[model samples]
Target chain A: MTSGDRGIRGVDSAADDFVARRRGQASAPAAADRPGWRPTRALSRAFVVIAVASALGVLLGRVDLVILALPFIIGTAVALRSRPTALPTVTLQLGTDVGAEGGDVHARMRVANPGEVPLSTAVLRAGVSPWVRLRQGHGTYAASVGAEMGNSIVVAGRAMRWGAHFFGPVLADTYACDNLFHYETLPAEAKRVRTYPVGEPFSADEAMPRASGLGGTHRSRRPGEGGELAGVRPYQPGDRLRRIDWRVSMRARELYVNHTLSDRDAEVVLLLDVGVDAGTSGGVDGKASVLDTAVRATAAIAEHYLHRGDRVSCLEFGPRVRRLRPGTGRRHYLSTLEWLLGVRVADGVSSDTRLLRSGALPPNALVVMLTPLLDDSSLSALAGLARAGRFLVAVDTLPEHVRPEHDGVWSAHAERLWRLDRENAIGELREHGVPVVRWGGAGSLDQVLRDVTRMSASGKAMI
Target chain B: MNDSRLAQRYHQGRAWLRRTQPGAMAVRTSVYVTGFLAVVTAAAPAIGAARAAGFALVLPILPTVRPMKVWPTALIVTCVAVWALTGEHSYALAFLLGALLYTHHTSAAQAVTMRTDTYVTPEVVTGWARRTGLVLLAAAAASALVGLLPRLFGRTDAIAYGLAGLAAVVGLGGVLAWLVFRKL
Candidate 1:
């Protein structure tokens, strides 16, 4: 369920569909009829110069003026000899529609001359998203197309970030008759390339607080017919004969059976705080912002639990309050990654916390809230979820190097006081029995989950 | 308000120049320099007023600004007029000025068709160069024929020469009309 694994399966199909759709559209008659040859300003300028010089030479009887006009006449007549009747066809073909962050994407722009006349020259200009950088300088190119021939410009670049990025709205024009007549095509639509965030390796050895599903990998506390042995007791009426411990029965000279814990699944709810985001994002290879850390961490945790046969869901705690229903399997894991692509910070907006008490969240489910903890609303939401008896773990997603911008003399002192206040708020959250832990990739939640599981078993309530 | 509009236009022009590709910029620079040199050479022997006018007209061809569409043509015509008025019919100088004028015209056309950031391919450059060279050869041969015709007929038959010039103008006018009226 890693981003790379998902991309390998999804990339080819997505790219094929996009290319097929574009080709189908380009083959239509309307597309062909849209572009036609028109004379450029250069042609008019040349004609004007020739006409003016010829008029002057004839009126004044100056042979030198006529000599000056001779080149213009020859050049213009030679250029106008072979006029292109039809325009060239332009299409953009993408390497893949889906890719992982830092993965390379290849694109080819094809300009095909459909006319009997050869194109003297053709120019192509394309616009690209800042997230994708093409290897070939700027996206402008010029080339000559022979009669009934085509030219392809290959553009290769890396996907710098995680999102749906566009390759181009490519603008192409062809010149013919010695660059006299020009035909320009309407800009082609940009191709979308989805880059998924790469998740870090994560695993947790601790048991879930409660297991609900009938069949899974986790061991439950209730005694049942399963792998992990609970104890040996006198045989009951409904117990199977295979469960009998022969050694214990023979030594005691009585019928005895082995008791085992049931294997059941648990639900994991990932709650993301998008009220505020801090730090500058230098793309995948550089420093990550708060949102970046939360997204990557969430993907890792979801993958870990989903791979273990546990149901996982995601919720955005912002003005929008976006939610994904709980589901299990490889398909759900892919859907989660797709959903994380739209994560954005909405400042000056209050979060709607009514979802906590709306029964949308399962009481026994482990709720992991990813937040920067820079805003009061997120802290209050975490406190409310804990107060409602939901198993909650608040993962601090703020980058370590992030600091407040200084503008005044007291800015440094103000930032220090702010840091102290944030520390105190974290301490207060811990006292309220909501474990606030800084997100450290693998084994991050093991200690916290272990303690939560102990508290759940004893039926302890938060203070 | 006019000042603000001018400032806006100036900024826009600067931005366009900034985005111009290095190769395209070089070609444009060459056009400017060649055009300036041609005007100065043609006007060198003329009066101060004509030289001043020629120099002033050439200013619009500077690479620092977006070239005025008519300025190159205007500058060439002014310089040629100045040369004619000087009453010196030096064939070598006329051919030299003609070559420079042709170069400026073709380069200006190439430069305008391209965007500010266009990466001009070597094929396109070579193709233009080849075509220009061929046309220059044709123009040189035609010029030699024109120069020879006057010497052979002698300058004494002024009426016949004027009549022939008038007929040539009429024929060329017909051709120009046909080109303009034809489907483009």
Candidate 2:
């Protein structure tokens, strides 16, 4: 299991139980009513030895032997002189509520002693999750605790994967004076942080084919507030005075206003296929699998279009349909990433017509689908999106290094047949006028976008 | 220049060891070996009585030196050894047992206070030493009191000494009962 999954079973399980119990309790459980301080087996053993050894020395007439029992005498004196103390209250806190994958999370636990007696030996053990890689700081700390003294212990570790990772409920075992008694506390509640997948910086200079929204960097054919001159026309009352061309008016003997192409934004819809991942799993540092490529490429594409002031939306069809409605802004981009973190393959494919509660996608919107074409469900979903009369492009996210896992004559034959079927699928997509291209890191979509723009302008736009 | 080179080499060797060996295993191994040597030294008073008792007492504590339980048993056994080998015999066994108690308590506490992946910091070592020193100082004061008790009541009658021993036992018993029953 990966470290992310390992934590779900170990410390997280205890945290779940603790949370359940806390929910079960109608009110706060009284601390004093709980198991009070009692003598340890070690303390009892010391008392037995001191009594038996001292008696034996008296009976045996061993005078010097009495001197040898001094340490036990002192230990007994110390343990008895000490008073029983109430258990301390501990709280755990993380440094931040959000972090990126491969970034560190800092944690601090505070232990407060609210008793009259001081603890000379205090050992605090904070439960750690396996998701924390390269763990630093001592989870186990030993120090003295006075009645008014509270301590803050710190620990830090790197998050190995992107997801909701949990850390906390420090278990504290402490001893009263002379280590005579030990008190243990249960595991605390787990704190979760959403680790977003750090997207690779994407740069695509290609101008979009269709611009739909009111204001953006892309120049639309319609005239509005922009620097690009479309033509000169007779001035209207509502037209801005700054747009008036004095030289043109002087020549034509009438007031003329400068007309420019409106700078408008486009609606970019990204359809992600999470149905099945083919080939070996070599993590981020190694060769990415089909799904890994799809997720990363989706992130890169979303970032690119969003940076250009385009309304971006995502629809994922695997075993379940997950969709984020069209929105624009920095917060919306973060919401899209947070939604993508929940993307995983379900048992079987299912579809819902309410992919957008806002109704069908705009006809002028540019639809980009990311899929490996390994499963027919995603292909069918893509076709449904295209049939809705939206312009579409399918980016093939299949890694270049994919090969059959088995080594045999029949296996080789089957692998060849699979590749042939995939090629046929791609050929069919092309027949429907959906351009398919491999996703390269930068400028991968430039040529296809340019071709689509040319085709759309020539009035032969394909749905 | 030669001294600096030697120091650099020493640092390199230490780093290599730190990378190769795990902290927990090194600590456990060092503790067990040192504990075994201390038990053998404490047992060196004689083979039959002191050695057998020392071996029996120290063997179980070698793996997990539960400082609280192990120290009391060790003190009792050391007292037996001291009484067995009183005059014209070595008193080194008693001193070694005291030192062993200190080392055993400190090492066990350190092993508990740190995780397997982490090493003992210099601050923790200093803390452990200071705590152990305070305990040893108390033990030393009590030993001095024991020595003074004999001198103050020297040449007393058997009846008076017996009565005194009985009173000490009764006083300890009453105090223990009161602490356990009422105060607790």
Candidate 3:
């Protein structure tokens, strides 16, 4: 992939994109553009001086050829040094929010030499760890630093869609001065850019906290106030008459009244999916990238529960599992963000059997699980967990419809295998009475809750 | 975790080694070797002659050695030293020209090979060591080529400069090419 040919994979795509966007529009006078090309000019001067020196001494038969070229040599010497300060403005277009599933992020920057001196030639370089694929743009460039010239450069890639990704150090160098004697260089700086998560708002008005601890309209099995006359048993000496069921008394011709309790609060557990598919090679421009969407979705879900005073906890499971014990405060949100910021897909989703063990979960908690069901192992575990209790709500992290591509025989086989696993996973979840909500619907979390609420409204999720 | 942090920083430094394409490293190594050998000869003649003769023997075989990786870098250094010491001039100029004229083509080619092999099997465990033998013969040839420049280019007063410039251009060109395309 040397410059011997311009057919660089990612380089051309990026350059073409920029040219098209600008429509060849002229750039304003940039300091780097104007006479900032010290290296380029230096090379030009070096060549002229050498040519002048070579012609004179050799033609004159002078033995001091080296002495004559000394000045030119010194001129080229500056190329080896680093620059003190360079102005390069980088802006990221991380479209919309990070959301429950990560989205796309595009980073665009222009390197300008604002100083009055010309640049001979310079290379502005930023490092990339393969996670962010270099889709298009010049990671390194060869330019002639002339008086007043500005070059707009970009590095575009499929970045993880998570909330925020960190960029490593950037190094800028000029051509020819690669020799220590002549290099012009600049100091390095640490950069931190935040890619905010997408917020998926749910309808607050419709949500009545499950009347367990939080407020709700429905009466509960435990002692709580409600306007219902439930069945009553014969009062032991301490039993109140209000606890008697009058209708039973009328039917049996005996005095027995009814006792009633209101619904209790429901706990919301947001189980986020941290899968490899959620990461990008370069910029986070893909759909439902784990970092991009999961973090944002988790935040949104946390907000949904916290606003209602329902206890909320988050489970970010990928290669690593980050859990925040359930809480109902602003601090919980901050803690969740901290986890999101640090969330990285180490590998495939972990297949911890404990997560799948039925009846292992805390009691009376509504299970809100999110995942990109690419594998059956996670599905199986969730299904087993669902069988342990009702109140199972599964949020599918899959895009609206993703049909895996099969290019060759092996790939076709792989694709079929994946499809088989997918069908089986969903089927198992449904069988166990876990309500599954496929992503891509508006109000992703809310839709899942509402749809699951509708399909199994009367009974808790079947184990 | 602290150990991991230390490992991370350590890995970063090691990564820097990888980032420095083998060709550039070879050229740098050759320059240092040339300076070092010149000093060995100037400072301690017996050691210098022995060292020079030993390297001269290895220089030709370097390109075809069992491990070609170091052969190229070694060959380049030997070639530059050969010219500098052949028909000696003042000590300073000999050192300067000797250091400058080291042939980087051998190292450059080796870098390309490394990159290609890396693509095939990115694991660092055996990747760098795989084709080391294959590079030895090529490095030997490069050393021989530099040794011949004195005869071919003619050791006139301007001769070394031409040789040094040519070497510089070729070495820098390879680097510039790598910088532009991110591959050697």
Candidate 4:
């Protein structure tokens, strides 16, 4: 089977495992076994007050003391008459395991009292990830529950950023007997919901520099079977009978065949430079940082190419050097998105350049490096790939309004110098025959790709 | 060095205070104030002890730094002792103190059950109110019955009446012990 087929199968099995795990969790007991109807401090206090007051009143012949103790006796006896014998079950259910950035996620917490006695109050506190903004504002809540009934608290919130966010490990306690007796439920397991980054709209009209696969939309230069007609030529012996142009044959008084360019697919490699993040991310609606720009732009580019039947892959140029193998189709697009969510800056670890020299990258693939042009190592790597005659395009993923954060008085001058140095590096990379373009939503890489395609057509070396 | 530690504790206490919800704080403050009022009213005839107990009840109002666990019950007991020692024999005052003491106990129980940051539903508050009202009604009925005992039966010897009250108290204690130990 092809790599794409294996990737699709892997995604299917992962989805199956997720469903099975959820089923197991649902069948598990809500809380650990414990004694039922335990007395709270309040109950003990009431009993002590009642016993002591009654003893004192009788000994001292004080009717007022006896009067003071009457309420405690009545309240305690009435409260303890119908004690809850079973623990309440608490479960937190998420609406979905997957969400889009800036999309709403719904969660329901059910506090069910299965016992015959009703609960006076149940206090619930849920721990939520910072990425999720719960509409309820606070995590702690108290509500009364009836016998054999349940309280369902629906929490709806918007996902602020793209990542795996946890929703629970909810701690709950049920108080019965007028808040005299209480029982605690075991903490529920935290639920993980992955929020996928919303890719910006992107499309490229330019043809790829190199197309290798047999079936696709791009017209290849080699003469073979395809839909786009190149020209009519004198009939060759190996030409199919269907390819013969009857009108051309009659006009030329000889057998002529239609020559069509082969439609073939190309490979697109998205290289993300995660060595350093430039700006501060303000979530999905706020100002996008360097890493944010890189991730979102990679998603947009991957979607554009994958939709056109091209093999797309991702490589993180960071300390870890993570890689996603080339694949195609809708499932591969989803896999690419899942892969992007884990992108983060690896602190204290130096970037490894071994992946570039490992020959893992295909010779004919177009390498689109998404970077902030901040690090010298990344620039040198781009220059090396260009010198190696690879079809390379460097996309500037830095936010325009980003400024250096420093307490020194020379901060402004330092920032200006850094920007100038970055501009010079870009110029050097372009001089090395690497096309550097700033990342915009659509047509960002069209002119660069067109120039690369023309150079490839001429069989000229990129260096 | 002690001052730094004290400052750290002060900052932490302030943070805890800030985290408390305004609505929850209001409810807790109301319960504490009611308990203080009850203590003051019960010991009103003894002005010295009444003022001291009322001032003592103010400490638990802070919630976070309460030095005593059973402050509400202790204050009520102190007030009742003051009322008895001051030679106050008015039945009406006894009945009022009884109602206020029960109200304070029940309200304080509900208040301390939840955390300061907890958002308590109106249903919980209303249910507690309803239950407290029922208990108060029961207490009032019992008080009235005890008062009628002198009218229904002729005045008995003090010794015999005291002995009978002692037996009743012992029987109630036994019943309470059985109820508590059976579950354990």
User: Per-residue error at B162 for model 2, in Å?
Assistant: 6.4
True interface contacts reproduced, per candidate:
0.48, 0.17, 0.00, 0.64
Q: Per-residue alpha-carbon lDDT of model 1 for A1-463, expressed as tens digits?
A: 0011111123334444444443353322233455577776667767776777667776777777777777877788777766778768788899888998899989888899988888877877666656776666577787888899998888899987787777766767678877777777755667888888886788999989888776778888777757889999998899999999999999999999998998888999999988887887767887778888888899999999999999999988887778888988899999998898877776556553676645568888999999999889988888887787888899999888788878899999998999999999999999888898898999999999988888888774742
Ranking by lDDT: 4, 1, 2, 3
RMSD of each: 6.3, 8.1, 18.0, 6.7
Residue range A1-463, candidate 2, lDDT tens digits: 1111222243466666554543353122333345766555456655665675567656765444444444555655655675765677777888996887678888877778888776655555555554565354445555566666776667777875555666765565556645555665554557876666654666677777788898888889887898789999999889999999999999999999998999999988887777676655444344566666766677778888887789898877565567788888787888887776666655575452544333535677887888888777766666666566557788898877887666576987897898899999888877766778888878888887877777678664353
- For residue A249, model 3's alpha carbon misses the true position, in angstroms, by 23
Question: For model 4, how does the per-residue alpha-carbon lDDT over B1-184 read when each residue is reduced to its tens digit?
Answer: 6998999999999978766775456557656766666766665677766575756467445432331256766766676666667773666677777777777777777776666777777888888889988988988899888877756765667777688789988887887777666652
Superior candidate under DockQ, 1 versus 3: 1
The candidate maximizing TM-score is 1
- The model with the greater TM-score, 1 or 3, is 1
- Across residues A1-463, which tens digit of lDDT does each residue of candidate 3 receive? 0011111123234434433332233222323344332223223333443454344434443323333233233323333233323433322222322322233434543445554434433444454323344454324333334334454445555544333443333444432222211232332332333444445664334343243564544445565455655556554576576666667788887766456665555567777656444322222343344344445556677776676567777776555566777776677766666565655555655654545432234555666777777655567657666665546677666554344555577987886787787777788777777767764434655655565555444555424
Native A-B contacts reproduced, model 1? 0.48
Q: Which stretches of candidate 3 lie over 4 Å from their true place?
A: A1-160, A172-187, A204-265, A275-286, A289-296, A329-331, A356-361, A409-421, A443-463, B1-184
lDDT of 1 by residue, B1-184 (tens): 7998999999999977666677666657756776776676677767554765577455635522444366666666666677667764656567677777777777776765565577777777788788888998988888888888989989887778777877876786677556645775
TM-score for candidate 3, please give it.
0.45
Is candidate 1 or 2 superior in DockQ? Answer: 1
Give candidate 4 regions above 4 Å deviation. Answer: A1-35, A348-352, A406-408, A454-460, B1-29, B48-57, B64-91, B150-157
Q: Estimate each model's TM-score.
A: 0.86, 0.74, 0.45, 0.85
Q: Identify the superior model by lDDT, candidate 1 or candidate 3.
A: 1
What local lDDT score does residue A165 receive in model 4, on the 0 to 100 scale? 72
